[model samples]
Target: MTEALAVPRIASPEERITSIIALASSVDGVDIVVAAHEGFTYSVQALNPEYEIYADELAAASAVYLESSWQKLTGNARVILADQGGKALLVADVGEGFTVAILGERQAVESLLDPVRRLATGAPISCPNCSAVLDVHTYTCPSCGKRIPFTATLCPYCGTASPARSCPNCGAELMLAPGRVEPAKAEKQRSAVAVTPRAQSNEGEVVSEEKGETPLLIRLTIGGGVVAAYYASSLLLGIDPVIATIVGAAPLAASLGLILTEKRRQ
Candidate 1:
């Protein structure tokens, strides 16, 4: 028994071709591709080329006819392949150039219609600096030497943004696209922690800090009392004055130690 493959249904031609182009682009060696209308006028509505196309290709007619026949009869798409030196094959949609047949390589794009549509419709975001589509948020513009912000209001280098809102460099007002300007958030109230009271306690703390005289005076008094006791004890004992001096100095030392400790506690 063999498993049957699911038939791809395309109700919308534009969406279907878009899916095909996206799939083809994923193929290795695919440079660019496009899908357009199935007519001779050749006004391309969609294309996935390496760069912006200035004019239509002369070889597009043959490719267009081949793919259009497949699409109409077999419900399948066709590809027009081109080689740019050693790079990927540039695949274009056969009929209208509204979709891409494939872009990477023949092997990679064998079953690729679904991918083309996804990619074409969901295009990658482009850089405001060099117009290169970026994968990640970056500060340095990959194409130009510009300092960009993580969340920039304007480009730091050229001072420009998409939709031409304002010149980042010169701060000039720019002509913006319709419905592009986002409304800014209104200012919110500050947190209570941010506000500090100016008034302070008056309990011997010198509401304002100044030179500490109380500590100095206490230290001076202690020194003076110790000196006086030593001299008096030396004169009175006369025999081994050092012992007498130590005895006399004990009380004064104790008082001074208590006073210093008390001041520190307060």
Candidate 2:
């Protein structure tokens, strides 16, 4: 009777970044998948946690710092190589206000770039055959051995259509934006070294940033008025030279004091 009442499960729950990285770990050369944003690591998706703890730490800091810094400079980095020593560092746009840092064999790790990109855009990946979850590690589905990549537009084995999408990073129809042209690539073409940010130990080292505008035209007008008054007092008024000098200086002093007062109030 219990067997008669049983029904098959429809599919796995919705896909997510955590599960995505778990699958990516199975890829032959992918070593680490970290979810990072704004100079902090939210999840060390996959790692050894021993030898890579230092690299991971550096990667996390640079991921957040360099990406944000680059955005401030170029309005977008499209992607950034934050830090690298034994491991290559990358911060690719994952959209949704977050990014994924993949550190491993540069070529192999890059293979999954499309996957991270899909996630950022809110279109998660799943197997075409059985609707099983998938990641870069999943070039071929275990559920049915159906070839995948989603970029292919249709599963060669299953004939299932790939979901249509508007890239979170680059809104191109089918092609990825070759990725917002890595910043270093531009410099390399121009003979420059846009290398990793130096990892230094200096408690006294200071990093600072500032943005705003000053009332330049106003200040210039104030100064011009003061100069005109100085000349008017000495040449036009024809009062006692000493008295005119003192009186002319008064307006200049008063104007400056008013300017300072206005700034302080703001």
Candidate 3:
């Protein structure tokens, strides 16, 4: 059997019946085939005498066979039927209340069944990323919009890399899809932006973030003022050390509070 087969669609009842016969004959080991109409009134059967089955009886039998076979397969545990002589029957859905009969030995018939099913059910290739049906010609997965090859370990669109269990670079237990946009990674990036002493462009204006280190002059000035005030209150004013410390901290706390109060952004 050929690798590719077209799934046929017919416009009319007559055309659908004709198509069933055409499809049946296309497969290997189809010694005799029949296409039964919706009713038992008319049927089209291949008039080959090599296989000894009456056409009228076959036409009637095929209709009943198609109906009963699928039910039996569903109901039974083994899901297959075989006669004592080793002759077997295999059935599959060809869609549209129509069935194509293939007459052959059990093994040969079974082999052709899956390939015919591929044609009838459409091409079976699927996207590993999204499970969407993939077009035979294109490597891009249409569903998730990933452009990676089918056998690739990672999906290029969604940062989903797999089968490794975890990321080597970050040691993240799960990197997830859609690249470094994952919540944990994104939060890390935000933290990086906040800490790094770099200027960022905000709508054509340069906005530089301040370095976390305090200025040397400001540190020296504040330290000198604190020591001088403490000594002056203790030695010159003749106040107790505890009293001087409390009094000194009162003004300093007020001044620091005034300076550190956050400005509201409008």
Candidate 1 C-alpha lDDT tens digits along 1-266 = 44422233333556455444433333333344444354222333223454335224423543554544433223343433443334333343433345443334433332233223223333323334333222112233344544332223344344455433333322333332322222121111233434555322453357323345565566668767876777786887674677766776776677677667866975
TM-score of 3: 0.31
The alpha-carbon RMSD values of the candidates against the true structure, listed in the order shown, are 17.1, 23.5, 17.4
CA lDDT scores, all candidates in order? 0.40, 0.47, 0.42
Question: What residue runs in model 2 are displaced by over 4 Å at the alpha carbon?
Answer: 1-16, 55-59, 62-83, 93-97, 124-137, 140-266
For model 3 the local lDDT of residue 237 reads: 71
lDDT (0-100) at residue 198 of candidate 1?
38
* Candidate 1 positional error at 31, Å: 1.9
lDDT of 2 by residue, 1-266 (tens): 22221212212212344544554565545567676555466566555555346444744565555446443212232455444566655555443344556676554455555555544343444333333323323444444554344333434345555434333222323321223212223434544443334533232243211111245346647766875677677777566666666765676676677767766875
Candidate 1 is scored at a TM of 0.26
TM of each candidate vs. truth: 0.26, 0.37, 0.31
The CA lDDT at 131 in model 1 is 35
What's model 3's overall lDDT?
0.42
The ten-residue window of minimal lDDT in model 2 covers 5-14
